[model samples]
Target: MTKLTLYNNLKTVRAQQKLSQSKLAEKVGVSRQTISNIETGEFVPTARLALLLCLALNKKFEELFYF
Candidate 1:
């Protein structure tokens, strides 16, 4: 069986937008550690949180995450 792994360009996108972890977290109602965890692939956000992040980052779902 083949497993799907999720990957993201969050760090790069976040850097390009000049948003700090704390700032983005504030916008998404999460913690800096949560953002860090997502960036490091240590956690997968809930679907609602993912959409919130997409809105906060001005990115589409595909732009934020992929398999």
Candidate 2:
């Protein structure tokens, strides 16, 4: 099976919305470093966290993350 890489436009979208990593993290109930990790591809968020991020950013899952 082929491995799929997850990619996101999180930083761009967050910047466009004028949200700081800390602020977004707070909204999603995670630490600022967690948000940084996700943005840098050092960590992939859990399904629940992904959903929370989507809700917090007002973005669809596909809009935030993709293969």
* Shift in Å, residue 9, candidate 2: 0.8
Tens-place lDDT digits, model 2, residues 1-67? 9988888889988999999999999999999999999999999989999999999999999999999
lDDT of every predicted structure (CA atoms): 0.94, 0.94
TM-score of 1: 0.94
Please, what are the lDDT tens digits per residue for candidate 1 over residues 1-67?
9988888888899999999999999999999999999999999899999999999999999999999
Q: Candidate 2: where are CA atoms >4 Å away? A: none
Instruction: In candidate 1, list every pair of residues with a backbone clash.
Output: none
> Any runs in candidate 1 off by more than 4 Å, and if so which?
none
* TM-scores for every candidate against the unseen true structure: 0.94, 0.96
Residue 10 Cα positional deviation in candidate 1, in Å, after optimal superposition: 0.8
Which 10-residue window in model 1 sums to the lowest lDDT? 3-12
Candidate 2 vs. true structure, TM-score: 0.96
